[model samples]
Each structure stands twice: as structure tokens, then as C-alpha cells.
Target: MTNPYTTAPMPPQPPLRPAPKWARKRYVLPALALAFFIGIGAGGASGDDAKTTAAKPKSASPRPTVTVTTTAEAREPEPAPTVTATKTVKVTATPAPDTGTVADDDSGADVYYANCSEAHAAGAAPVHRGEPGYASHLDRDNDGVGCDS
Candidate 1:
């Protein structure tokens, strides 16, 4: 009896077919993008055409012509006017007196703080020049405000 392991020869395998060439996304994406841009351009051109067609004049009319004429006459020259009289003038100015006190709308000039930290602690972080607890040291830029930081 033939051996159980021995089997009929397997039919020859069919030849493998080559894979179909696929369009790469790198090329296809750019082509699609170019097509989209061209479509948009075409749409814009068509829209402009529609507007121009709608705005076109129904009939053409001849433009009117203008004619200009000029005439000149001879005339005598006029005499120059003479000056009647002249006078001299003098002016004087005086310096105004200096005022020691500053005029401020807010009345907190007496309040003083040693530093920005002290002012911040006292709930007065930003102090203007005329406001209370404002000092030159607290304002680094000297913009008339203190404890700005």
C-alpha cells in the first residue's frame, strides 16, 4: 500500500500578478490643490464677466464736442500808491511771582511711604505725583507716578 504521507503532487502555483501602480498622494494632493485654485480663479473670472455683462450699456451715444474762443484788449498801466506816514512802538514785560504750593484735585499730599513695598502693604501700590504716598524713589522712570511696579 502507498504511504499515507505520500500525497499526489500539488498543482503548479499560478504566476503572481504584478501590483497595479497607484497614484502617489504627494503628486495627487498637489494636482488636486492646483485644480482647486484654478477652479476658484475660473469662478472669480466668471463672476467678473457676469457683473460686466450686467453693467454694460444698452446703447452707445456720441460724445458732445466743445469749442473755446478768447479775445484780448490793450489797457493802460495804473500808478503806484505812496506811503503817507510811519510810527515807532515800544513794549514791556514783567515776570510773574512763584507759588510754593502745588494745585492738585486729590487731597492726599501729606501721606508718605518709604518705599514701594510699604505703599503696596498699605494698599496704595500705584501712587501718582500729586497723590498721597508718592515719592521719586518709588518711581524709577520718574513719570510722576510711584510704586508702579
Candidate 2:
């Protein structure tokens, strides 16, 4: 006795799956768009870029004017200083008159006794003409009257 259907074997079959649509178009279009935008942006930034400038100084307007007033007082004149002068004088005093002159009959003694003796004896008269009693005594020089000399 012998078994049949053992002469050959069949190959194994692989599993099946779904495929993506436009997959290749997807990466190529995006990469090209990215490169185009980047080149345009870089070219615009590099060549003939716009520059900003500062404004110029303008002329200034004229300033307003102001006025001021002041008052002054007149000066007064200065007064002159006062000055005084002093002088020395020599004064001579005369004696009282007697009854006789220096050379009269009674002589100078009569004049002394009549007019001067009373005050002379009391030590009241000065000794000489220039002295206090000189005026009270007789005319010693025989000039004109008692004490006149």
C-alpha cells in the first residue's frame, strides 16, 4: 500500500495593502514653493534696500521782547565843618582917683595917703603897678596922679 498527492509543494502568497495617491507630487511641489519664496525674500532683502533718513533742522521763530523800568534818587550835598579861633589878651586894671596929682604941692605921698592908705594898710593893695597894689599906691614915677605912673 502507498499514499498519493506527495509529489510537489506550492509557494506562499504575500499579504495585500492600499497605495497612496499623489504622494510623489506632494513633496516636490512644497519643496519647489519653499525654494521659490526663500529666493524671492533673500533677493529683495539684499539688493537696493530702502534706507531711512533723519529730518533736517528747521529755522527758529523770533523770541518776544521784554522791557524793564528803574527809579533813582538824587544825591544830597555835604555840609562844611565849622572852625573856631582863640586869642590871648593882656588886661590892666586902674586904681581909684586921689585928691592930688603926682607933682602937686602934696606930692605923690598925698595921693597915696588920701586915696590908697586906707586899703593899703589893710594888705588889700598890690605892691606894683602891674601887681594888685600898684594901682592903689602913690604915683611912684611922678606921672600925673596917684597910681597913674
Identify the candidate with maximal TM-score.
1
Identify the leading candidate in terms of lDDT: 1
Model 1 has an lDDT value of 0.71
> Which TM-score value belongs to model 2?
0.19
* Residue-wise C-alpha lDDT for candidate 1, range 3-98, written one tens digit per residue: 768787867999998655564665788999999999888777566778998898779789999989888887888878988863332322222244
| Deviating ranges (above 4 Å) for candidate 2 | 1-21, 46-149
Q: In model 1, what are the clashing residue pairs, if there are any? A: none
Per-residue lDDT for 57-107 in model 2, tens only? Answer: 557999998988888888888888878764433333344466555633332
Per-candidate clash tally: 0, 4
